[model samples]
Target: MNTVPGFRVISLPRNTTVRVHRRSATIVLTLVVLALFVLMLTVATGAYEITGNDLVATFLGGGSDMDQFIVLRQRLPRAVADLLVGAALGLSGAIFQSISRNPLGSPDVVGFATGSASGGLIVILLVGASSVASIAVGTIAGGFATALFVYLLSSGGGKVSERLILTGIAVGAMLASVNDYLITRATLDDAETAKAWQFGSLNIISWPHVIPLAVLLAVLVPLTLTMSGPMRVLEMGDDSAHALGVEVGKTRVWLLCAGVALAAAAVATSGPIGFLAMAAPQLARKVSRSPGISLLPSMAMGALLLGAGDPLAARALSPFQIPVGLVTAALGGLYLLWILTWRKG
Candidate 1:
């Protein structure tokens, strides 16, 4: 294994070493490089076919005004927004999976996204609160509430595992029903807007959505990363974690809070974009071949997934681009089915 600047490229026979595990590090770096290449390719793809040279010039601030405008204002921001949201969702999913010790314990699986959607709908439908902040707050409230409900339902004398997954699925179904009712009962205009929001979209991402999400990620991701030790401890089972000086309950709570916050912020910023969060972490862990969840790799994998998906969505139909969420949801649903069946057999 050769170590490069801030990264190591791992060779075949993988060993289990703690400090900067070479295999995972190398694989992650490789994925990141590939992701960047894909991102640049995507930037060049659009309604107006911009050449690689033009893309490079535009990136270097040497292209025509129109090129700059298209690249910088329209496409670039959308790409960045996708990266942020995807990374957030990926990290959240990874954290949740690690904490719950179950692959099925995702925000969508646990009803956090559905719950957040319900909250956002309440603001849009009943309270007449159309502001972004209101929606963001509602999403956070909804996600945390759903998590709390699941926790309470699954908690027994002690421990949480398979019960949590069952509880989450049930809660998720209930919240999804509530979300549907809210949408169906609203006016046509409201219903349309809610539909778009609920299905998720990166359509109207302005500075407002991008800036707040960026800031939140900057603060939360690092904080969550610092809790990795406790998270790993929790994976060893609650009693063992407690025995190992890890505050079992507190660690779970912190991870849950952080995961909910990340998911809610993403959902609020771009509605509950299906599968990016859920899929990215799983993909990252699989690709990296890590024993437990790999947070940083998951985030990178997410950014890569969305970074690629955005361009695919942009150019898939030319002038009329389908929302990024729908594209991801379709693919995600298929991938999820494959994983579930593969696991079963």
Candidate 2:
């Protein structure tokens, strides 16, 4: 056995056990490779019936014009969007849960998802906002507003507690009610449009959404990676972090904002697509055997969950495609049940 600077290595006759950090990195790397394979699979298999050779050839710049148009123009963009959305939500969820030091302390728990949905609904139902740009703005504003509300109520303790959880649930329920009321006010056509978007389909995804999402991830990716070190320190408790020269209050706020940015961006693109933020971190922790909330593992899991689910959703009903959100929601429900029962037992 040998010890490295940041981690320990254990070598045995049959196998080896590396420390948590290295193990987590290995898990993430595996997930990334799997995600790439899945991306190619998704691009190749779709309703549009492109032969494998043609699809691969198109990817390599040799397919016919129609195959090129279908694969390049349509399939590739949605696949990229799914990956970005998953990574963003996964990273954001990991940060929030790690800082909150509670499994329940995710952006979804704090009402950011509902807040974003409320924002989009308000833009659509109130302002008759149909353009993508307008919806994106409203969704982000709503997320920020929700975070502000949750923070104001939950900040006294300097840590996430049951009160924060309860308050967030209350606020989320209220926002959901607001969404219902807004839907009531919408015209039938607008309501249909809003309903469809709310369910979260990749059909709305194209160049416009994909470009901004790429840029958003490019910025937040580095910021979240930088924050992970301090976040680990923060997990020890407020007094401990402060003693270690980490500004507890400022760090908490910045982490919350950063988490909200990632969550809000995902919500904007996918209409509060559920489950990834809530489940990915737990799944990552379990799989990587990490001592704490490993952000890289969570991001990789989120990307894999959502990215792979997209094609499954497409094929679930054969000729008719189901929204990927529903698939994740169903999976999340099962996960929640298992955790609850397991914990109780």
Per-candidate local distance difference test: 0.82, 0.83
Encode model 1's per-residue lDDT on 312-337: one tens digit a residue: 78678877778888887778768879
Model 1 misplacement above 4 A: 1-18, 51-65, 341-345
lDDT of 2 by residue, 1-345 (tens): 566555666565668453447788889999999988898888888777888788778989999998988888888888988888998889988987888787777777778888988998898888997787888898999999998998788767544555666778889989988998888888999999888888878875887888887898888888877777678988898788889999888887888888888898888888878877978898899888787899889999999988898888978888888988878777777877876876577
Q: If scored against the real structure, what TM-score would every candidate get?
A: 0.88, 0.92
Summing lDDT over every window of 10 consecutive residues in candidate 2, give the lowest-scoring window.
Answer: 11-20
The candidate 1 region of ten consecutive residues with least summed lDDT is: 10-19
| Residue 9 lDDT in candidate 2 | 62
lDDT of 2: 0.83
Say which candidate scores most in TM-score: 2
Off-target runs (Cα >4 Å) in candidate 2 are 1-20, 341-345
